[model samples]
Structure formats: C-alpha cells, structure tokens
Target: MKKFVLKPKIYFNEGSMEFLKEIKGSCAFIVSDSVMETLGYLQKTIDYLNETGIESAVFKEVRPDPDVKVIAEGMKKYLETQADTIVALGGGSTIDAAKGIIYSLWQFRKAAGEEFKKPLFIAIPSTSGTGSEVTNFSVITAEGEKVCIVDEWMAPDIAILDSTCIQHVPQSVVADTGIDALVHAIEAYVSTEATHCTDALAEKAVQLIFENLKALYNDASNSCARERIQNASCIAGMAFTNAGLGINHSLAHALGGTFHISHGRSNALLLSAVVEYNANLNSNDSRYASEKYARLAAVLQLPARTYREGTINFMQAVKDLLKSLGIPNRVRELGIDKSKFENKVETMVELALHDRCTPTNPRLPSREDLVGIYQKVF
Candidate 1:
C-alpha cells in the first residue's frame, strides 16, 4: 500500500504566530539557534506560549548543520524541563535538531519499555526553505557525513508560517533558501515515485517560486512575495515528502556535508548540472525526466512546443533564475581549492551514490555520471 502523509495542520497568514496562544501543555520546550535568540524570535515564541500560561525552557544550542552531539544535548535539556511540547522556532537546522531530539526520546523510551507521552511538536520556520516544518525528513550530521532520517512520526504536528518571523531577512539568505525550495519542487516533480497528487502540489510550488522568488530576493519587505514564497516552500516540502527526491538532493547532502557548504547554496550550485544530467539532452533520447521537465516548463508557460525544446527551455530558465538571484553558477566560486575538491571527489561520490535520495532519481547515476557532473560544476 502506498501512503501519502500530509500530517501537519499548517497555520499561515497574518498574525498566525498567535496560534501559540492556543498551545496546551505545562511547559513548551523551544529548540532554536543563536540567530533566533539574537533576533528576539525566541522571545516572541515564548511570549505567545506564555499567553496560554505555558512555561518555556529555551535550548538555543542548534547550529548551521545540526550534529548528533547537539541533538543529544538538546534532548538532555528537553528531559530536564519535562516539557510537554516542543516548539522548533528557526530555520531548517533548528527544526531538524528538534526532530532529532524528539526521535531520540521516542527510541529511548521504546527501548527502555517505559511509558512515554509523545510531546506535541510544533515548528515555526524563520526562513522560507527546507519545508522541515511539514516534511517527515530531517538531516543530521554524524561523523562528518549528512544522514537523512525519514519517519512518519517525525513530521511536526503543527506548522506556523508567520510573516512576523521572516520579516527583513537578508537578501543572501532569501536567495539561498528560496532557491532550495525551487529545487525541492523541481526534484519532486521528476522523481520516479511521483504520483498525480504530488505532481499537483509540486506544480503549484514551481509556479509560486517562479513568480515570487525574485521579488522576495529583491525586496524582503514585500509581504505578498514573502507569504507566497513561504507557501511555495511548504507546498514543495509536502510534494517531496510524499513523492521522494532524487540525485540532486543526494549529491547536495554529500557535497555540503563534505565541504561545509551551506545546504541551500550547495543545492543551488548543483541544480543546473543535475537538470542537464537528468534530461540527458545530448543522448537524443526521449527520457521520462525530459517529459517531466517539459511538463513543468509548460506550466511556467515557457515556449516548449516539444519535449526537447521544453527540456532545454527549462534548463535555461533555471540557469537564468540562478543568475538573477546572484547564486554562484559554479562550484569554484565558493573558493575551495581545485586540488582539495578533487581529492575529496571519491569520498563525496561514494556518499552520494549511497545517499537515501539517490535511488528515487529518475535516472540511476553511476560513479562516472556523478564524477562528470561534479567536475562540470567545478
């Protein structure tokens, strides 16, 4: 049986952060990062929960790429506070760290055969990317490798998309995270496991990204653009969580983890090459991916009279979008020395080949295929 999980009760629109006032729990454990603390987002969340008379214990230890140690540390604090709820209030990393802590707690209690009441999990994203708030996937680093953990119960019970939380975000962050959402939509649309249901969500997400990402990047204060991009991110997350992702994500996880690159920027750099690789236009074969990509191009109302033209148009549109956003089009732009990147090639390739996202790739890539793409990006 194939099951599509759309579990989160998402709250969006103006003043949606007040949903926290409806939170029911003795104490809400908030998982966030230093950035959120500095921006007073952490305080904003606490205040909302406080309105309901719920206590708060803040764990502001999450980092860019949440590692296993920090999750353990957060769990220790979670247990100490005896929090009945968990409010993940930040970007993807903070949300993933919160999910990890909750997952660990579940496993520990199950192993110990102790009765445990599952905490109510709520996610408040401070950025419009990753869709960690709605998806059952979480990435945590262990031993310097990015590991994606997928579980039905790992999805947040509630997702709040409050514009208040995302106001005046930096342009660089807007570009990076917005592009990640675009990648999510594109990858899911062409994933081998994609169903009609997922296609609908992914298509709408693609349209939204194309329409609003540039506007948001140019003017972070554009409330309409901001809300739409956030919606697009969540929609794309819903799409991929149900449809599964592909080699782009696999390669990105490996590349980012291996080099300490920002996840969104890493995905951004690899996107064009991945599209070309998957489309395989040079092979002159009418591939499934080409058709899927063509469908998206058609949705964007690009001049795609045929699948081939559609594929080419799609690739070019993506490149143009990246250029418009000021995202680096080549891996070399990140300043990693050529020799060092080449040296790590084998390690990255192996990790990518074995990544959870690879198997669902429309075209199963071999070592040579992966190597060529990596070198092309360089």
Candidate 2:
C-alpha cells in the first residue's frame, strides 16, 4: 500500500495572511529562531495572529540544527503556556523544533496517564528550502548525531508559503537552501522507494529549481524567482518526505551534527560527488542513473551529447553552482583536515548505513562503498 501525506490546508498567493483570521484557538505557541526574529518576521507573524484575537507567545530557542536539549527547553515553555496551537515561523529548523516540542509534550502527557490531544498547528516558511512546513518528518540532533522523527500524525494542519518572507534570507542561504531543494528532488526521484506521486512532485521541483535558483541567487527582488524557488522547495519537501532521501542527505546529516556545518550547505557540497559515485556503481544501471542526470544537465543548459557527457555535465554544473554561490566545494575547504576525514570515514559509513534515509538510496552502499564515496569527495 502507498500513502501520501501532506498539509491539510495549503494557502498560496497574495495576502494569504488573511487565513490567520480563520485560526480557531485562544492562544498560539510560536516556535522560531533569532534570525527570523531579528529580521522582524517573527514579529510580523505574531502581529497577524494577534489580529485574529488569539494571544500569542514565542519560543525563540530554535537553533540551526535543533538539539534535543533545545527542544526540551521549548517543550517546558509550551507546557507552561498551555497553548492549544503551534505556529512555527521560520525555516526547517524552526518548524522541526515545533515538531519536537509537540511530540515531547504528547509523550510527557502520555507518561503521566493523560490523553494526548493534537495541537492545531500552522507552519509559515521564511526560507525556500526544508519544506518542513508541509512534511511529517522532524530532524533533531542527539548525542552529536542527527536523528529523524517520522510520524504521519505529526504533519502540520496548515502550510503557508509567503514569498515576502524570503527577501530577508542572505545570498549564501539562498544558494545553500536552493541546492538543498534540488538535492531533495533528485534524490527522491532516483530513490528505490519512490512512488508515482513523489516522482511527479520531484520532477516538477527539479524543473522549477533548475530554472529559477540562479535568478533568485542573483536578485532577491525578483519575485518570479522567489515564488518559483519557494514552490519548488515545498514540492521537493513533499517528495523526499514521502519517498525518503539517499547518501547525500545521510552524509550531510552526519557532517551537520558532528561539525556544525549547515545542513543545506553540507548537502550542496556533497551532492554532486555522491550522485556521480552512485551512478558509477554498475554498468547496467549506469544509463538509468545517467538519464536523470542528463535531464538535469539539459534543464541547466549544460553541454551533454550522450549519457557519459550528461553525467559529466551534471557534475560540473553542480560544482559550478556551489562555487558561484560562494560555498566551499569540499569538506576539506570547510577547514577539516583531509586526514581527519579519512580517519572518520568508517564511522561516517556506519552511521550512514543505519540512517533512515539510506534504504531508499538508488545505490545501496556497503561500508566500503561509503568510504570510497567519502574519500573521493574529501
């Protein structure tokens, strides 16, 4: 059996903020980060929610890679306020923090023999990556490793994508997050677990991103680019959240938790190499893998005459995109010594093999294969 999970209420277009008035609650618990608050986004969301006559309070404790301790602290605040609803206002990390808070709350209540009540939740994305607003997956770091919490019931009731919120995102963030969306689409489409619905979402997302990411990177004022990227991010999120991701994400997760590298940036740096390595795993499967890569190359208008040419073009395009975006191209460029990476490759392999995202990878990498991919990227 196949199941597709998405937000119950999705509002898009000009002045979607009007949906705020329809919120059915007395108090709202907002989860956000300092960046969004500093950009005045959190305030804007609070003001709008307040206009709906709902008293609102914010838990601005969400960090880049939401840690278990941070979530626990937020849950403490949530329980204290007795808020009936959660309004997550920011990127994936902030929305994910809200997920952790709600789940922990239910678990805590259940432990005390109290019935679990679902919170009326709304997610408003400030950035175009992460699609956390629409997905049921929540990622949190525990014991210096990133862990994914999956449950269909955790899907938000509503997802609000406002292009205006993306204006404040920095250029580097745009590049990293945009690449994150691209990686999500490609990985999902190529995933062994992919379904028809996810494939459609992923393909459209890939097309949208290849067309608009550069424009958004070059000019934030371009609303057309902003809207496309935002829409693509959500579509990619929906795809990967259902079909799951692959080695690129698994490796990125390890790097994020271990070294504090930004999740999207880590993914951006590693995606091309992982894709190439996976495609090279078997000659018979080569054409199948190369076809999607060739399509990617064509979408970006790179040079590609054959499957081999397509693979090379796709790799080059990804590397060029990362360089143009001012992101470091390799783990070594991020200041980690190459030797450290070589020594840690085994551990990374073990962790990645067990990652929830790994089973769906087009290439089911063995420990040695993971090491080889890491070494090449390193």
Candidate 3:
C-alpha cells in the first residue's frame, strides 16, 4: 500500500516570524550559524521569544555542511539547556543540524530507558532552499562523506516562512538555492515513488521556480518574487519528502562532501548532466522518466513537438538559467583540480550509489553510468 503524510504546521506570510511570540513554552533553544548571529537574526528570534516571557539560549556553531562533531556538540547543548522548545533558524545546514541534535537526543533517551518528551521543534528558514524546515531528512558530513539520516522524528513541528529573513541573501545564494528547488521538483516528479498528490505539488513548485527565480535574482527586493520562491522551496520539499529524491541529490551529496562544495552549488553544477542521464531514452528502459520531463517542459511553455525535443529544450533551459546566474556548468570550471577529482571518482560513485536518495531515482544508475556523468560534468 502507498501512503502520504504531511506532518508540519506551517505558518507563512509577512509577519510569520511573530508566530514565535505565541509559543507556550517557558524555555527555547535556538540552533543556528555564525552568519545568522552576525546578521542579527538570532537576536531577532530571541526578541520574539522574550516577548512571550520565554527564556532562550543560542548555539551559533552550525557551519555549512554540518559535520558529526558539530551535531554531537549541538546535541550536548540541547540536553544541557533542557528547553521545552527548539528553534532551528538558518538555511538547510542549520535546520539539518538542529534535527540531528534532536534525533540524537531521542536516541539517547530511548537507549537509556529514561522518560523524555520531544521538544517542540520549530524551523525558520533564512534561505529559500533545501526545504529542510518541513522535511524529515538531515544530511551530516562524516569522515568526508555526506550521511543522510531520515526519520519522522526529525521533522519540525512548526515551520515559519517570513520573506523578511531572506531579503538580504546574496544574489549568488539566491541563484544556487533557487536552482536547487527546481531540481527537487524535477526529481520528485520523475521519481518512481511519485504519487498524484506529490506530482501536483512538484508541478506547482517547478512553475513557481521557473517563473520567479530570475526575477528575484535580478531584483532581490522584489517581495512578491521572494515570497513565491520561498513558497516554492517549501512546496518542493514537501514533494520530495513524500515522493523521495533521486540521483541528482545522490550525486550532489557525494560531490559536495568530497570536494567541500556548497550543497546548492554542487546540485546546480551537476543538474544538466544528471537530467540528460536520467532522460536518456536509449539508455533507460523506461519511457516514463522522459515523458515526465516532456510534461515539465510543457509546463514551462517550451516547444515540445516530441518528448525528446521537450527533454532537450528543458536541458538547454537549465544550462541557460545557470549561465544567467553566473553558475558554472562544469566541475572543472569550479576550480577543482582535475587530477584530484579523477582520483576520487570511484569513491564518489560508491558513496552516491549508497546514498539514501538513490533508490527512488527514475533511472537506477550503474557505477559506470555515474562515473560517465561525473566525467561529462568534469
């Protein structure tokens, strides 16, 4: 039997951050990054909590591509604070780190036979990427590999989407994360686990991203565009969380972890190659994936006389979009040493094949196929 689940209570809009003032908890623990602390978002969050007479503590150690040690340390803080609520306030990395902390605490409590109550988890995303707020997935770096941990307990109980938080994001980040959302929609639409419900959400997310990403890139102050893109990110997250992701994420995780590339940028760099690989009618035994790509093209109002034409146009559109955003289409262009990348290709392929996101890929890639795709992008 197939099942669909929607877990989080999402609160969005211009004043969504004020929702923090409604929390009934007496104590709150915030997990975020140094950038957020520097940007005053952490203080802003604490101010809201304070208005409700809630005491709060901040852990500002979350880094890009959070590692196991970081998560462990965050877990320790979480337990030490014994807060009734936990707030994850940053991009994907911060939210994921917060989830990791909560997950570890749950495991520890269960193993020790101690009575424990899961803290009310809240996710306030400062970036319009990763949809980590609503999803029950977290990626942590361990021993130079990206490890994806999935469990229902990792999902935030509440998600806040306030455009004010993303207003100051750099144009480059806007491009990288916006494209990441597009990839999420594309992958979810073509995933073997996709259902009608997931397809609807994914389609809407794709449309929102294609229509507003460029506008936001050109003018970050465009509030309408920012809100739309932010909504699209969460929508795509919902779709992927339910339908599961594909090799696009698998490859991105492996590549990002190995080379210390930014997650969204890595996904952007590998998107076209992965799309072509998945849509290869000759290589893949199933036409379903190609048909889905064609449908996506149609949604974007691209010319689609045939499925192959639609697929080609879609790939070209992706390349064009990346170029317009100043994103490099190839890993070589990203300044990774060719010799170093080549030496690590086998390890990357192994790690990607084992990634939790790979099983739902429309086309199950062989090791050779993965290597070829990496080399093509290289």
Candidate 4:
C-alpha cells in the first residue's frame, strides 16, 4: 500500500522565529556558515534561545555541498557542545551538513553499541529551495561525487519559516531556488511512486511556485510572495519526501558535483531537458507522463487542449520562466568548457544511474539515454 508521511511541526509568519523562545531544551547547537553571521541571523537565533534560558554553542564552518570529511568534524563539535537541541540555521547546505553530522553520530553510536541521545532537531531555512528544512533527505559530497541520504529518523522535529529570514535574499538566488522547488514538485507529481495525497501536495506546490516565484524574484522585499515560495518549497519537500524524486535530481546531483555549480542553478539548467525527456515529447501519442504534464499546464492556465499540446506548452512555459529569471537555458552559458564537460559525460552518467532518485523516475534511462540528456543540456 502507498503511504504518505509528514513531519516537523512548522512555525511560520513574520515573528515565527520567536518559537525558539519557548523551546524546552537546555542547550542548542546552532549550525550554519559565515553568511548567517554576516546577516546577523546567528545572533538573533541565539537571542531567542537565550530568552528561554537555553545555553547555546555555535558551529560555523559548514560549506556548500557539505563535504563528507567535514561531516566527521561537525560530529566532533556536535558531541563537544553536549547540546540537547540541534538548530540548523541556514540554507540547504547548512541543514544538510547538520543532518550529516546527526545521522553519522547515530550510526556510529549504534554500531558501537553505545547510547545515542537523539537531539530535538530544528531547521530554519534562509532559502526557499531544497525543502531540506522539512525533509528527511540530504545531499552529501565525497571525492567529487554526490550522494543522497534518506532516512526517516533524520527529519527535523520542528521547522521555522520566518519571513525575516528570506526577505533579504538576492534576486538571482530567489530565481534559482524557486526553480529547485518546481523541480521537486514536477518530479514528485510524475514519479512512479506518486499517490493521491502526494499529487495533491505536489500540484499545490507547483501552482504556488509558478505563481509567486517571478514576483518574489523581482522584489525580494515582497513578503507575501516570499512566504508563498517558502511554503511552496516546504510543500514540495513533503511531497517528494513521500512520492520520491526522479532522474532530474539524479542528473542535477551529478552535474553540480562535477562542475561545482550551485545545486539550485544546476537543477534550473537541467529542468526543461529533463521535463521533455520524462514527458516523452518525441513520441507522437501522449501517455501518462504527458497527461500529467498537460494537467499541470491547465493548472497554470496555459493553452493545453490536448495532452501533447499541454505537455509542449508546459515545457515552453518552464523555459520562458527560466528566461525571465535571467537563468542560463544552456549549459554552455555557464562557461564550462565543452571539452571538459564531454570528458566528464561518462562519469556523470554513472553517477546519475546510481543516484538514489533514479529508481523512481517515470522512464528508466539507459547509459546512452543519460548521455543524450547531458548532451542536450550542454
């Protein structure tokens, strides 16, 4: 039987950061990179915990992609703080790093036959992408290869979505991350494992992201738009966490890890190519995937009378959206040498094939199929 799951009590709205003030934990270990400190959110989070008399320590060394070696180091710091609460206080990378640290410790303690005190995990997202705040999934990189880790026990106990956290995001970042949420929603909606419940959540998230992302990207100070995108991101996260993702993520992980591209940007670049591949647009007749894409087009109010027409329109719509956001539609625009990328094609295909997200893809891809996708994007 197919089952849907949701977790992590969410606190949102303008002053939702205040939720930390009521947390009953004795100590909080805040995990983030230097950006939070530069933006002064680190101090703000500590102040909220301080109001509740919860002492806190900081681990500020996290980097993007969450290198596996550093995860071990973070575990050392996590233990050193003796924290009962674990607060992830940045974007997806920071949260993923925190998850890596927490999950690693649990595995270590279990293997050693020692007691493991599971901390009450809290995630505060500074970006509207990855939905890492609400999902039991994380991406970790080791030896220039990316791996997705999924475990029910790694989900946060609470998620705080304060408007103040996202109100100052860069417009470019807004575009990239918003598209990341779109990828999650669309992938989940067409996933082989999708259920009625996941479809509902994914559809809502898709609608929200399409409607609000452009506005939010144009004006970072638009609190209403920001909240909508944030909510959409989390909703998409919940949907994919249950419905599962597909080869879009698998390809994205490979692309980002190989080229050092930001995950959001990587996903945005690959989205249209992946959509076309999954929807079977090259075929004359529409099928399940095309029908689903057509339905999503109808939701967006695009002209989609026939399933094939709807699917084509939706693909173009995504391309139009990416263009409006100033995102690069072609991989060459990112300035990666064609020769280098070609050289990495085999490795990318291998990584994508082995990715945890690949199994749930609507279409089972062969080696040549993955190579073709890379070439099309390139």
Where model 2 places Cα greater than 4 Å from the true spot, the runs are 111-113, 285-288, 295-309
Compose the digit string of candidate 2's lDDT tens values, residues 1-378: 767766558887546766887787889999988888888878877887788888988899888888899998998898888888899988889999898889888888889999978889898988898988888889999988999888777789998888888887889899989999989999988887788899889979988987889888999999999999999999998998888888898888877777688989889878878988767834766466677677667766777787778778887777776777787867887888877777777777788888888888887788888777777766
Model 2 poorest ten-residue lDDT run? 281-290
lDDT of 3 by residue, 318-373 (tens): 88888888898689987899999999999999999999999999888899999998
Report the candidate with higher lDDT, 2 versus 4: 4
Each prediction's whole-model lDDT (CA) = 0.92, 0.84, 0.92, 0.92
**Tens digit per residue, CA lDDT, model 4, 20-121:** 989997889999889999999999999999999999899999988888887988989888888999999999999999999999999999999998888999
Please give the distance, in angstroms, between residue 339's alpha carbon in candidate 3 and its true position after superposition.
1.0
Q: Report lDDT (Cα) of residue 320, candidate 3.
A: 85
**TM-score against native, each model:** 0.98, 0.93, 0.98, 0.98
Report clash pairs, candidate 2.
Answer: none
The alpha-carbon lDDT assigned to residue 166 of candidate 3 equals: 94
Residue 58's C-alpha lDDT in candidate 2? 86
Quote the lDDT for 82 in model 4.
83
- Once fitted onto the true fold, the runs of candidate 4 whose alpha carbons sit more than 4 angstroms away are 284-286
lDDT of 4 at 198: 90
